[model samples]
Target: MDMNTTPVLQLTGICKRFAGIVALNNVALSVRAGEVMALIGENGAGKSTLVKTLTGIYRPDEGTIELAGQPVRFANAQDAMQAGVTAVHQETVMFDELTVAENIYVGRQPCRGASGRIDWSKIEAEAEKLFERLEVALPVRARVKDLSVAQRHFVEIARALSQDARVVILDEPTASLSQREIRELYRIIRQLRDAGTAVIFISHKFDEIYEVADRYTVLRDGQFIAEGALADITEQELVALMVGRTVKQAYPKADVTPGEVLLSVENLCHPTEFDNVSFELRRGEILGFYGLVGAGRSEVMQALFGLSTQVRGNVRLDGKPVCVTCAADAIKHGIAYVPEDRQHQGAHLTLPILQNITLPILSKVGFFLRGRRAEENKIARHFAEQLELKAAYLTQNVSELSGGNQQKVVLGKWLATNPKVIILDEPTKGIDIGSKAAVHRFIGELVSKGLSVILVSSELPEVMGLADRIVVMHQGRIEHTFNRGEATPEMIVSAASGNELAEDCA
Candidate 1:
């Protein structure tokens, strides 16, 4: 971890453009060996594009890339890998059926001397060595699909190390990991740094950045804002650089007194998922569900939305019993759900924004009999405008939009359904502070209009800020419920971590 040595990887005047949109403009970055350089930016801040360029996924329209004091131009990902530059993405790509060792050496397996046959034993031994080096205990013979999320990440890292990667880029590696898993990952990162590997850590969590990074690089709107030692700047200053302005209020929640109960669940149970879950949602109320990753918060929401078939519960809407057997039934009951995985469950990436937004209400738009484009546009435009979606046109593909804009599209689509009870799961996950504030404001406006919202989020600040009532879940049951004024971070966290002081706080 020498500071005086030359950077192992360097980029100068990097510019990347896509279909007339400038994704990265004159961005410069340098990563010295044996250091963890954190790449911090808001969503759509050109971080992904820069990483793509670095990995040869997308060639920069203009730039100079240097590796080990020599100019290098990678033709493709394989070319970059050969040059000792590799990236382990958030959504890991590996053959689920393959063994951990097989996946680690899939295409690059060592051949038996003179025999030209695959060397399986060597591969397993090598994977074992890599795991040992990372101080992680993982079976080399275990199937990839059988591994946990954290173990899968370890396999990805092992694969990168197998390629002898000097510059390893980790893209949002901790997004879905638990606190303990995150700590393990940090230890592995430090190990890599100590071994003289330049680690590029990309994340939105400021606490993680402060804890792990040795240096910081900020990107905003496709340009480099600043770079300095991590110890030289404060969190607020870093946030300001990423968003181009100080966020006056990260949570712009408006005060609203909830009215009569709109929806109530009694003894909701899903065999192996959650058990005996019960809650009430009042009119114009935002009820927040806070829990750890495996606390079964999302499972409860899924069951309530009719996505789980084995769910047993008594749901009363407006004091009347309602049975929702499927998503269609849930929709018919005036309950709309924005799923946690926006990319997979929320919106169709290949479809246009307008089409995605109008998908839920196609029949309402006369699409069953004779679809009217005008009607679809009108409905899509109304919600799109309301959500302030930033898109070039209604016909633009959702895949082309940024993470924040993609989330807005998902919200706009569900809002078009005009549901009385809307369930938003991790609504602002992976979005920037500015987008988060905008979403909070929108939620406030919705509740002001008498719309009841059920918010499920892993983020404590978001739940505390927007929820009028906080419901903490652990394992598979509701452990505690607290009114807005009564909840504290410590209590909520303790409950979420399965250390609830009481059986029921309510």
Candidate 2:
């Protein structure tokens, strides 16, 4: 823990492979106490694979891992944690039925007095103490299932902190967080570093790294490419190192004439999650919904797409009244939705990529029970090509692809449905810049073909560049609508935060 001392962790000559895929090839990384060492690479570039090897999700094929100058091999994640290492992954793994406190201290619960029973009150009190230290305001007694994604993540971090970990790895922690939550997480990370914890942060976002990381290590094609102090490189240069090329503008935007209203929602209500929301999506127009997490944006999209059963709304498609009581009804009315959580609601991970794409339109192709293999393959191949999906073959499992490729599967699946209205929720999350651009361009093409798009995104720049018109939401209500020229990052943020436009917020 000395200021001028050795790194807390060092990995040299790390190599890993799965079947024929060489995931990490001699990757080297080091993390120092009181510093945030950012490990960044595109999806499938051995970032998660490397972390898994270190945390015992996979044993490295060849490598030397040292903690505090002594070599060590983690037999499992629990072994790593006991050895003062912990990781919070992109997806949270918490016991939903348990209380937040119980989830935080699942393995190491405090003992009660004479009865020798698990002390539930003590558990809640200890969790509250942890929350106080991390400045995370989560209800300790609340069921983990009731918490938002961001709150669950904070619980994970609090658990790690409670363990007094020497090295903590946070992988894409901000992916589900709002702007306010991101700033809060940054403060907590700074606190962790100041307390002498070596933080190994991983993210695809460049701006966040420069904001919070002290040193950066770039991995390319499963090999270490660069490592140095953050001050030594600019954002553009840092991106070049991480990606091995220049990334131009994020999206391909062109002027598209707005045609007739394709989809109209009036008095839409999902009584359980969100209520009283209304908006219009015009043909050849991208309508963006921007708000903080829990702003009910995704809920509104779900209601429109017929996922929530309690939805009450008047929906008009091409000026004709439509009641979407179920997903089939929505699809029958030419509506498609790509949900926010890809792992849970989007793709059928156990199935093949080809099956996922063609599953929606199988009946339409006149193939119901069996012997539809040829038609299914054709439909999948067409969309795979259109979306630039990279896969060894159509038969590959959907879960085997990287996050970006998995997202492509989701888009291709909905696109195969051939709907007039497409609703996308956080479509580009965890995807690389190239893939993000490709996805955005595909949205442009969809709108160009007279398809209406309702885009829900947390990235302000993305919304600014892609949306022809933006409808800001706050506290489950539409705050204000802005044309592309009228919206700025500041203005949109103000609206999303439920503040009157800053120029008039008084």
Candidate 3:
């Protein structure tokens, strides 16, 4: 990385506000050419606001932005792109109906001879070249709707590269990627650095920052806290800077004695997804399900939650057989599920936080909210305070909150249902360390109150730290089950990978 060159992108006194609430206060950042700068912050600490400001989605109320030592401002996204600045966001924004090649070069297609007709062949050829440069195999003619999450991210990166962008902002690029895809993305970031591109990498994972970033910029409560070389700072110091205190542990488990079984699933079978999946959740206990990407853990949970059809299973609550054929049936049986895809399945983003929290309980609180606004506000405020939700007000739209706050809203929605069993699938997947600790503490608090939990996670540390017992699945079948004191990381990973350990290994 070149250190002596002038910064490719620099911001000074960047201040932004929404309805008189400060989102960014005198936030400043600088990124030199050929270097990876890690933008570190907790959710709602103004990282997303800063990214939007840089990408031209939102104009700063007070600030000066300079590119290559020249003052400039972008009126819109197109203007920012034309000025050699681009951002590949976590939530991909692209036309699902368009092919990959078309999505990459949507507006700027090469023109034909003098007639200036659309040149389809050149577009596909250029897209193929870009994929080849990145050493990824993707069908250029395939529609983006059929692509996976990682594939969509690759398409966004290709688009950025195709535009010859000098400054690239990758916001949580690896959040949805598998381990192998994450390694590939790391290589791509290094390639961009080698080619003299200024990369602003934003992620909640510390190991990723330490691996790929050369410098660090920390934000705390909408203000700049620190900026320096990554090599000179320890991970502990960075966490302290971002959250203003020491987070001693990412997973905090509470001690609660397991009671009799509260929920039992026997021979849970989903046609073509999973076979003979069985588990027991006792009151005050957290039963964890760990597996690889396609291990069918989520499929089993979805079927149990009545989201899948043709599911053959016998579920009992407190030793009484119950029938759950759909979402409403499951809710009636005191079962609540927090889905992994929070945006699509968990929270109603267009609704206000108060409305979302009280949605599941509309049967009790009349749908006509004209006379029941006070009741709705009381319920929402109780959960919001319990979750420590950082939002402007109960009437604030869920879409306006950050990722962590959005997840909290979803969680509050389910908790408002007051279910006996809550199934949390990857609850803290994309949130930062501070928010993760808060969630872990909340989980402990839930179990202490005698609510059984079914935690389905791909992260090993989370499962091992919080689960009273773990059920490891491999290829849609139970590979092993380990008691709390018997499981090790190696044993659990091996089981998840379909490798059988010796009898004494655990």
Candidate 4:
């Protein structure tokens, strides 16, 4: 990979404004061929907007994009793809019913000479060649819906290569991949770089950025902060640039002793999702659930929250047996769940912050309010302050907030219910380092106030740092449980991958 060559893609003085809110202001980025540039930023740091601008999804209010030493303006995503610039997003947008080969050449398939009919054999051959180049194997005739997440990503990459793309953008590609799959993706990225493809890698994990990226570009609050060789800076320094300040402790675990058991589950079974899942959440304790992508961590939590059907379990709250058959039942039993997919399940994006916060408690507060607007405001304001929520006003919609602030609103909404037990599934999955710190502190505060927490996270470090007890799940069953100070990343990951360790059984 050559660093001295002329950049294959460059952006200068890029600015994008939405409804008078500046998303990107004079941001600049340069990506030379045969190099991987890490785009580092927190949630709402203009990374998504910049990606949209680069891909022609959103035209910048002011900027110039240069590809191969020539100015280029993309009228739409198709235009950008034709210009040899393509992006593989985190959640792949592919036709589920289409075959892998068909998806690769869906828009522009090779036609038979003279006849001008679609050449299916040529399409499959070309798709095969693309996967061969990437050193990955897949059945070209397999339907996309039958493929795994990693396979879907490979298909997207194959599509990029099919278009003869010189600049490829990968946005959080490894967020859902397993350890082995991630390693494979890393190898493919290096392959693209060695082939002189300029790659822009976007991720929230610093370790991944440092491991795969040759150079670093930092964006904060819609502006470029710095750009340099990754070797010249430390992770702490990079984090400081992204958040505009140093995060001394990413996980500030408070000292809280576990009290008597607050909630206990015995033989919780979700039939297909999970089975025989049993755990106890003590008052003032954070019980962590660690697992790989399909380890049934979230499934178990959903069942506990009464969001799953045909779930058979004996649940006891505060020493008394309880039955929770629905979400309302869970809420009535003092259980609140903040789901992982905040956008779809956890938050009502179209609703105002005030309404979203007080939604669950509307019955308790009188649904109509009856001129109790001040009381509604009072409730919303109290939790907002507690969560340190960042919003212009309570009337503002949740859709207007950043990922971190939106998660805060969800937290505030559930906290408003005053539940004795809260289930936070992947609470800080996509937020930045600063927002993660804030959330970790809040979790600590929750425990200190005698609130029991069930933290379902795929991040090993987070679970180990914040959990009093870590439960490892694999293949829809509990593999092992580790008390705090006794669990290591190796042990947790090993158990998560279904390779239970003998030494950690205790």
Number of the top TM-score candidate: 3
The lDDT of each candidate is 0.90, 0.86, 0.93, 0.90
Per-residue lDDT of 228-298 in model 3, one digit per residue for the tens? 99999999999999999999977888989999999988998887999998888899999999998899998
The whole-model C-alpha lDDT of candidate 3 against the native structure comes to: 0.93
| TM-score of candidate 4 against the unseen true structure | 0.92
Off by over 4 Å in 2: 1-4, 108-132, 135-142, 269-278, 365-371, 499-506
**lDDT of model 2, residue 92:** 91
Model 1, span 119-179: residue lDDT tens? 9999999999999988899999999999988899999999999989999999989877888
RMSD to true structure for each model, in Å: 1.8, 3.0, 1.1, 2.5
- Arranged by TM-score with the best first, the candidates are 3, 1, 4, 2
Cα error, residue 176 of model 1, in Å, equals: 0.7
lDDT of 2: 0.86
TM-score per candidate, in order?
0.96, 0.90, 0.98, 0.92
lDDT tens readout by residue for model 2, 114-210: 8879988888898999999887778899999998777888898888888889999999998877677789889999999999899999988888998
lDDT ranking, best first: 3, 4, 1, 2
Model 1 misplaced stretches (Cα beyond 4 Å): 1-4, 368-371, 500-506
Best by lDDT: 3
Local error of candidate 4 at residue 464 (angstroms): 1.6
- Candidate 1: lDDT over CA atoms? 0.90
